[model samples]
Every structure is written in C-alpha cells, then in structure tokens.
Target: MSISPSLDTDDLDAREVTDGRYTRVQIGAERAVKVRAAYTTRFVATEFTKRPEDFHMLAGSEVHPEAGDVVIARVTELGKHTRLESPTSRRQLLFVGQEIMVAYGNRYAPDQFLAHVPDSLEPCHLVAGGGLAGYVIETHASIGAATAIEPIGLLATREGVVNLRDFSPLQVGSPSLAAVAALGSRRPPVIAVLGTSMNSGKSTTLACLVNGLSNAGLTVAAGKATGTGAGNDPNLFIDAGAFPVCDFTDFGYPTTFKLAYEEVRNLLAAMIDEQAAFGADVVVIEIADGLYQGETSRLLRDPLFATYVDTVVFAAQDALGARAGLDLLHDAAVPVAAVSGLLTASPLAAAEASAWIDVPVIVTYDLCRPEVAAALIPVRAALL
Candidate 1:
C-alpha cells in the first residue's frame, strides 16, 4: 500500500470529526505509528490471517489498503432503536438475536417462516398485518414503507427488517446504528473479555473488570452483547458500583447464538452509545464463545472488536488454550491484560499461563472472592 503524505497533524484534532474515527492520518512527513487515532473509534488494520487470530474488520476509506490491511475502528457503545407502528402494533429489534428481514416480493417474503420461527419466539408475534410470515420493515433509507422479509433471514431491525445478506445499513447513514454512519470523530479506549469456550469465565472476568475499574475511582459502563443471560453480569456491574450496567437481556436476545452479523454490529454500536451516555470512563464488553470457535470465530478476529478494544482479557481452561489465546492477541495487536480460568489441582498452572500468555494469570478457586476483582486492575493498567 502507498503511504499518503501526512498533512498538518495539529489541525487534525480528533474532536473535529463527528462520525468517523481517524484510522490513518495524512500528516506532513511522519509515518503512522502505533498511536491513538484522532478519535477513539475503532478500525481494523487487516483481516486474512497467516498467523493465529490475525483478524481485521472490513476495509476502510483508505485507497488500495491491501486485502490483509488491518482495520482499526473506535467502538461506540450499543445503540438501541425501538419502534411502535401506526396501527398500535409494536415492532422492536434488539441489537442481537433478532434479524431484520427486507421483503422482496418473491423470495424475501416475511411471512414465509411462520411455522419455523424459533421455539424460543413461540406464539409468534402478532404483527400489524396479522403477523405475516414475512413482515414489513421501516428504514431511514429513502425507500418507501414496507420491505417484507422472512423473520429468520433478518440480521437486524428496529421497526423494519434488515437483511444480513446486504447489510450496508450499519455502514453509513445507518440511522439506527451510528449517529450518521460516520465514525465518532472522538472515541474512547475499549475493554473486551473473551474466552476459550462456553462456561470459561468470560462474563465473570468482565464483571471483575468492571468492578475493578469502578473500585479504582474510574467510571465504568458495562455491556453484554451476547450470551444466554444465565448469570447476572449486568447486575454484578451495577452492584460493583458501575454507573450503568447492561446486557443483551435488555435487547431481548439475551444470547448471541441466533444473531447475524448486522445484528451483532448494531448491538455493539448501541451498547457503546449507551455506555458513553452513562459517561463512564471505561466500557467493558464481553464476547461469548471461545475465541477460536467456528461459530463466533469470525467475530473474535473481527476488526470491529479489535478496533474498539483498548485491552483484551482472555479466559482459558489450560496452558495450551492460554498459549493459543496469547498468540492470537499478539498477532492481532490487541493487548492481553490477563488470563483467567478454573483448573483442577495443578501447581504450575498459573506459572504456565503467565509464561505462555506473558500476562498475569488468576485462578479462582473460591468463585466468591471480592479480592479477585481487584487483582486485575493493576495488571491491566500496566499494559498501557
């Protein structure tokens, strides 16, 4: 990729941009370094991986930014869009789990899947038109009123269905996603928690991070974009003194399994917005599923998540997984703050985790220690 000549860095204040975060600045002479963007919004530098976890977000505004170019973005909190249609019928789209289907007269019929709607969504919602298998959607796009779509094909929705097959809506002018589809000119550092499989302590680590940060005299806002809503991570964040704590429970998905990509990104954006609104100093988001799982693997290496993450903490089960996670984060340029896990009796487990991941590893036997949360702050801060 050709490097553009840098313009005046002084004039390129991060506070100026309203929507997008500056990925690479064209300043006078100096080349870009591993420095913060003018805005804190996240962008990916690259996507394809020759190494472990070398994931990136989609290509950005840069011209000819190579296929593997890393994309870094400033992640905003999750944004929520709820709609009540004119006929006293209410259509709500949570950031996750719910799909936004755009009905095309032929294949995109919203009523097509009336029988196949998930058992979880049983009793099928009584949509305005008597809940057509395909439902009408309303979008801020210049298009007219109803875009019929099968509920299952939906990636996201507010009052209208958004098809994941063509999800440009979250890109720019996505009235429901970002303020104006522009990156937040000014963004903030992000904190993320990832794990090595289901039940690997991801949410628990996130709670600890929120509590740890809050106890350290910093404002904290917590978000749970995915998960089955088994534990009360949101409640834990609130109880730990965070100003505002939230989870997909609020959006109604309460889990990440059925969510599509468009739905996930919008949910993430909405959560960021929510956190920012709370004015918290740190925003923590937890990613469910293993970092290397086939289902969520794409998101694990996702540039969106990477760009938004200031620090990434991984929960592991053993030294091997710890090593794999550490290597992945190192390749992606996401800082690994610490490793958390539960193990049987192994004296060398902590040492093994620390040596491999190159960060402090905390093994909790009590599963009820208040001090466990505090232990993470100093270790995490040191990475910065």
Candidate 2:
C-alpha cells in the first residue's frame, strides 16, 4: 500500500511516545507490547472519504521502510471483500524518508496489489510511525452520536501521529488462538461483557459492576473489547477497582479492520483464557461497537456471543433502538442479562424504554434502585 503524503512519511523520526520509558519503533509504541491487541488496515489516502489527502501524496510509492518504519506490507490475501493482510517478512525495515526500494528482491507493486481488491470491498491501508502506528482504516462516518472516543487535543506530535492511548488492543491475553486454545484447555471459568451498540453503556456499566463486584470481595479482572482507541476505558475500569484491565492495543492490532472474524474470535478466546489464568473471581469486559449493527452483528446472533460472553448487556440510545435491540436478541436467540443506555440517565427516558423492553432497564446513576444491575448479575454468572 502507498503511504499518504499528509502522513509526512517524508519526516520519519524515532522518538518516545510522550513517556520516554521505551523507544518507539515500527507501527507500534515501544519495541512491542503483550497487551490488548487491536487491528486495523490503512488504505490509500486519496480514496479517503474524510481526510482524502492522506493517500493522494503517496500515489505510486512502494513502502521502503527505514529508521523507525519497519515492514512495507502488501496485501497477500484476496477476498469477496476488501480485506488487507499483513505480509510475513521480517526483513522489512522502517527508515527515515526511505522511498521503498522497489527492486530489492522484487517487491510487489502497489497497483498490482490494489488490482486484487474486489470492487465491492472497501479499501484501506496500514500505517506506521513512532507517535501513531497501526492501520487507520477509512470509514464513511465517525462511530456513534455519543462517541466513546473524544480526542484530547494538545498531544505531542512525535513523528507526526496520535494513536489511541486510552483503550488499545495492545494489552490483552495473547496474540493468536493456537496459544489461547492451549491456555484455555487448562483454565477455569472467565467473566465477560457484551453489548448492542456504541454508547450502549458498556464501559461505564462495566466500571460500575467492577466497583460493586470488587466491593463484594470478588477478585475482578476487567478488559475492554473495542472502541475508538483514543480514550482510557480500561483505565476507567481499573480505577473502578478492577485489579487488572486491558484493551486491544496490548495485542498489537492498531485497528479493528486489521482483524478477520475468526482471528477476532480466537484472540477473544485467548483473552478469556488469560483472564481466567489470572484467577480473577469475576471477569468484566467492555465490548466494542455494538451487536446487531453489522454483518458481524449477525454473527453475534448466531450463537457466537453465547459461546464467548458470560453475560450480555444491550446499550441503546432511545426506546426504539432498545426495543429493536431486544427483538434482535430474541430473533438471534441471544440470552441477554439486561438493557441500559442514555435513556436510563433520564427518568422519563428510562420509563419509555421500560415500556418497550420488558427486561429490567438500568440507569447507572440510580444504582440504589436494586433492579438496575442487581437482577442481571446472576444471569451473567450463569453464562460464565
């Protein structure tokens, strides 16, 4: 894939990511991290819908990484959709202003690579830098109305980037399923979280649960599944009294687009294994995006979520979405513990949603209302 001019690949620098503890290298922070792993693939900038110029600059250049930049990845996998794959070559190097040496051992052409991307599939690229690394996939719209990721301005523009410091896939269980599967073969029960939408009260709700569960003397370990990697959801969970919390960044995937369906499942299973291995009494998880919102959502319906998550919570914005979410669960046969969302924050809204979904509706603010999260704890445990 071609690098974007807006990326300023012209000025690649090897620097520390704010905290000078570890040297930043490649498309990730530090040398590497055994943390929650997140995945995303970078696409051509000219093709970008929002910041179009990111790809326009590197129209024909092949990635010849130098200094800090390491692998110049070419899509090795072709699919019905535009799925970018990571090339397996350790020799790939990240250098300063290194116009990828095209003839070295005959690297594949970017145009040739794009040729295989099906017309129906959305396109993206993999980006790397000291400050911000990993794949930044192109999206038509920003995630949700109540976006979980709020960019904190005034960030140091080291090597010109701003990766999500808050909830990354960098700190999770393991990198692959093979290991996770092996781990799970010898582990115990694990606690997990699931959801229906973006602002569906997953993270905040997870924090509240952790606080309560911890108070009840459970050794709680928490983890965040997905979100815009720009905020500190895991930190919030940690502060909420979780002894340990992790996100995708710890796993090494910078964006979700970089992960395949089976890969995500395997890694999640691995995370469950790790959490169980950690020996936390109850594991709390925050799911990314939402269930029933995409083709993947259908996957959630097809017994996949039941297989993975211990308890499922549907977060909705309004009564209509809440009802729709509940109906989707019924259709998919997903046994959910309870429903919660912005509506619960307001009394009138909660009452409205309660009318739509018979399941107990929780508004985290009024935790004293015993029915809010009280009823769902057992349901969640049943899944575990």
Best by TM-score: 2
What TM-score number comes out for model 2? 0.55
Q: How many backbone clashes does candidate 1 have?
A: 65
Q: For model 2, how big is the CA root-mean-square deviation?
A: 14.2
Candidate 1 lDDT tens digits, 104-222: 11111222121222222111221222112211232334323432222221111121222211222222113333333434644445677887776677766676666666656667778
Q: What TM-score, computed on C-alpha atoms, does each candidate reach?
A: 0.49, 0.55
Number of clashes in every candidate structure? Answer: 65, 59
List ranges where model 1 is wrong by over 4 Å.
Answer: 1-185, 343-347, 363-384
The true-versus-predicted C-alpha distance at residue 9 of model 2, in Å, is 22
**Cα lDDT tens digits for candidate 2, 279-314:** 676666666666543434645654655676655666
The whole-model C-alpha lDDT of candidate 2 against the native structure comes to 0.43
Displacement of residue 130 (Cα, Å) in model 1 is 27
Candidate 2's error at 154, in angstroms? 24
